[model samples]
Target chain A: MLYFILRRILMLVPVVIGLTVIMFAIARILPGDPVALAAGPNATPAEIEALSHEFGLDQPIWTQYFHYVGGLLHGDLGTSLLTRRPVAADIAAYLPATLELVCAAMLIAVAIGIPLGLATAVWRNRWPDYLSQVVAIGAISMPRFFLGLLLQLCFAMWLMWLPLGGRLPIIVIPPPTVTGFLTIDTLLAGDLHAFTMALRHLAMPAIAMSLSPLATIMRMMRASTIEVMGQDYVMTARALGLPRGKIILKYVARNAVSATLTVIGLYFGWLLGGTVLVETVFDWPGLGLYATKAIVSQDMMPVIGVALVIGLLFVLANLVIDLLYGVINPKVRYS
Target chain B: MTGPLLSIRDLHLTMTSFDGAAHVLNGIDLTVQRGEIWGLVGESGCGKSLTGLSISRLVPTPPATYRKGEIRFEGRDILKLPLREMQDLRGKRIGMIFQDPTTNLNPAYRVGEQLIDVALAAASHDPSVLGCPPGAGRRERRRAARRLAGEMLERVGIPDAGARLDNYPHEFSGGMRQRVLIAMALIGRPDLLIADEPTTALDVSVQAQILKLLKGTVADHDIGVILITHNLGVVAETCSHVAVMYAGNIVESGPVSNVIESPAHPYTRALMAAIPTKASKRGTLKGLGGTVPNLITPPPGCRFAPRCPLAIPACTAALPGAVDLGADHRAACIRLEALEHV
Candidate 1:
């Protein structure tokens, strides 16, 4: 098993490097003049040169890549054009809110999606199966923007049972040091006022972002469970006279988890992309919003920084998934 | 002593498809007396597996629907029983040993837990996850299940049954798993044990061990056993009674010696001749000539008529009913009477 896992870990190097190259190319090609945007349209010629020198944008592409990487090692992300603060600190403040929201949404997605998928697979022709299938299909096909609006209106406007957007109320003082995001810090301090407000604010957007991925997870899980149910081991379970439920839980679930892990990991990485639209719609302050602003304003350093961070996250997520194969599937061994 | 444990009369099944319906089993008749080992022999896609599945109520329908049949187990008509009753009967009275040891047990569970569960399920009417049924209660049931599982495992030649109970399916060897399956089957102490091609997926050497284990286990329980396989040698060694199925129909059935030495039906003879034996080195193995006929459009009279070398026009006139030649021997072929007097 150790041998197999070692092989998997070694295999990730080429994959991460390839992804890094692609992200680099994408950052360069996206329409933006970081120097001009940072200095502003009305800045004098010398001011723009000074800003370009400060960002090291005046260097050749390869030099810039190395210089940025050097800056990355020191935890410097240049200055945010909008906030005039270091991009790393800005991202540190913003990354966690998006992280919390995505995590919450993914939790809900997995909880609802996996069971629905299993239900559909087991009761292949029953009403529950058909209903789940229909709902998942609609969720998958519906545009995320429209669904976000619908969720917001129902949960935020009419029911008013939950807060629709924002991290928390202004009266709620964030911790002395905002390490990741204010919500987590507030919750850590056991500040109920702030924690409840943050949670309520996160609900609609989290639920909204979860819909499409939930459908995706459901489809994958359903197919995997159906495929596994026919395996010889399951038949063995049947011939052994195990109860129908135990057979499903023990035999079917174990075999299904390995396949499910890869899908979940891929979706987790993809969630970062979906977060942009979700965060905008809900007015949630997170990396997605920062990314969008940075991209639109041609703020090269921040845009590149976000891409690198997102790319790194994607790599790390996939690596975790690859490692998980060892745990879920006995056949997968890391040396 | 007198009556058979399981008797099937006029067992017919048809499989429906988008194009048409295919007749699978046709007026089949079989009986397994107590403590006897009966082997049903057939090639792949023959109704051999479907027959076994029917006994276990595992056969899929929508495609398959029984036309008419009376599957009498003990004295009750199992086919007529309610589904819940049938479920009750399954692990208790009609334990099945499936083909492919690797696939026969749930891979995720420890061998011990599954074995114990089957044992408990078979020994009692009520079901419980960890304990004995309500009347039996939880603690007693778990103990009984664990004890029986240990005993049965030991009987089937597994070493250290107590220690190995926690080990999952993948931990055991293929041969060991089959032994585990046999233990599961006989743990219920059912009147009849149905082992469907138990050694089909095993190594030739492992096949012998499994067959020996099964035969010994059946004898110990004095349970009538129905062993389904394509291997004539397996039947010759393990079965007292042999039934040769062609397509879905049983063409010949009698004492194993009679069926193997002088098969009455053409298809049965073809099947025996097809087996490669040590005695017949060169072309002793004469493979069946024609492909199986499409079951959807099985010939009017006999499904095997198209494949039989001795087939004539009269053979296809109608499906052959069982031709009893006396002394508990029967063959279903249009030419059986003309071809033999024994």
Candidate 2:
């Protein structure tokens, strides 16, 4: 397993390097100048040139790429043109909110999706199976932004059951950041009231973001489960008179869930970066919303930084999933 | 002195498919005595394996339905038993080993873990069936179960039984895997064991070893066995009694010697003729023409009438009843008198 993980990590170096080159080239080809946008339209030509030189945009593209790569090696992600703050520090502040939301949403997805999938597989072609299929399809096809608003309107405005989206209540003082995750930090600070408020605020957006991925997970799980139910080992398990629960959990689930795990990891990494529309609808302050703002203002550094972070996250997630194969399946040996 | 361990009376099974209903098992009667091995011989798709599966109710339903019959184990009606009791009966009172050893064991689990799972199931069954006290402590029970699994592997001739506990199913060779399967089936000390083509997926040398192991185990443990296979050679070597099946019906059955030497049914005679003996090795061995009839629309009367060389006009009218040939020998055929006289 150590060898597998090491090889995976070693393979990632070239990939990350390749991604950096693409991000750099893509950012440059976009029809906007961050230096010009920062200098303002009314600024003198000399002042514009000065700002460009300061930002290293005046240098050749390759020279700029080398300079940026050198800073990146030391963990500096350059400065945001809009905020003028270090991009890495900015990402750190915004990432935790997105992390919390995506984690909660993924939790919701796995918790509901797996059982739904199992039931559908067992009761295949029955009314319940058809009903669940319709629900899964609806969830997958429904637009995330529209779903977000609909949830907000129902739960907050009409039912008055949950809070409108935000990280926490403005009137309440947030707990000091230890992990930067609001829910965990609040609990760590012994602020139960704040934690409860955080959960209520998180409810709407999390549900909105979870639906599509939940459908995807359920579909994958259902397919894998149905495929496994026909396997000879399951027949052997049944022939052995293994209790239904053990047969489903041990023999069937272990084999069936491996395929679902890969999808879950992929969706989780995607959720980290792809919650742009969901974040905007809920007015939730996270990396998605931050990236949106950065792109609009032509802040190339932060946008590039977000892409690099998200790409790295995707690769790491897939690596972790590959490692999980050895854990779930005894046949999968690291060597 | 004692009644047969298992008796099937006029067992009929039909399978419903998209095309039509298939009469897969046609009024079959079979009895297996304790401390005896019964071989069910037939070509592929003859429903021999299905019959074995039906005994334990392991055949998949939705497609399969029992038309009429009573399966009696120890004089209690198995068909009448509730599903939960039936589940308890499987692997505790009755165990089954399937044809393909490559697929029968769960690939993701270590052989020992699967064995322990069976041991655990056996341990939880009624104490009388288990033949021991339920034992004390969960930890002690688990350890005991593990030890028993190791012992069973050793019994089946797997080398380094204790050390091989952690090996996955894929690690074992085909023959070794079959041994693991045999070990699993017999580990519960089941009253009856059903082995479906247990040696078909193995090489010739391994096939002999498995047959020997099965013969020894049945004899030593006094457990009844229903060994389903297509090989007449295997049946003749290991079985005490043989039932020759054709198109879902047992055409002829008796003591192995009687069935082999004085086979009453034409299908049985044809099957024997197809085998390559030392005398017939250089010559063109006789082959049975025509395929096993499609069960969905099987010809009326004896399923084998179309393929039977000795088939008479009356054979096509209705299925024949089992004719008494004496000494526990019987054959289902319309021309029993004519054939006997000849």
CAPRI-style class, candidate 1: acceptable
Clashes of each: 18, 0
Worst 10 residues of 1 chain B by lDDT: B124-133
Per-residue lDDT of B121-238 in model 1, one digit per residue for the tens? 6655645333454677667877878977887788889999888888777888998988988888777766788888899888999999998888886777788889989888899999
Best by lDDT: 2
Expressed as tens digits, the lDDT of each residue in A186-214 for candidate 2 is 99999999999998888899999999999
Candidate no. 2 TM-score: 0.96
Per-residue accuracy of model 2 over B1-342 as CA lDDT, tens digit each:
378899999989999999899998998899999888999999998899989988888887778988899899988888888889988888888999999999989888899999988888877885433344555677767778888899999999999999898899999999999999999988878899999999999999999999999999988999999999999999999999999888888999989999999988888888988999788857687899988899999998998999887788889899998988988899999877677766
Regions more than 4 Å wrong, model 1: A1-32, A78-82, A175-187, A333-335, B123-144, B276-284, B305-314
Model 1 CA RMSD to the hidden true structure, in angstroms:
3.2
RMSD of each: 3.2, 2.1
lDDT (Cα, 0-100) at A42 in candidate 1: 100
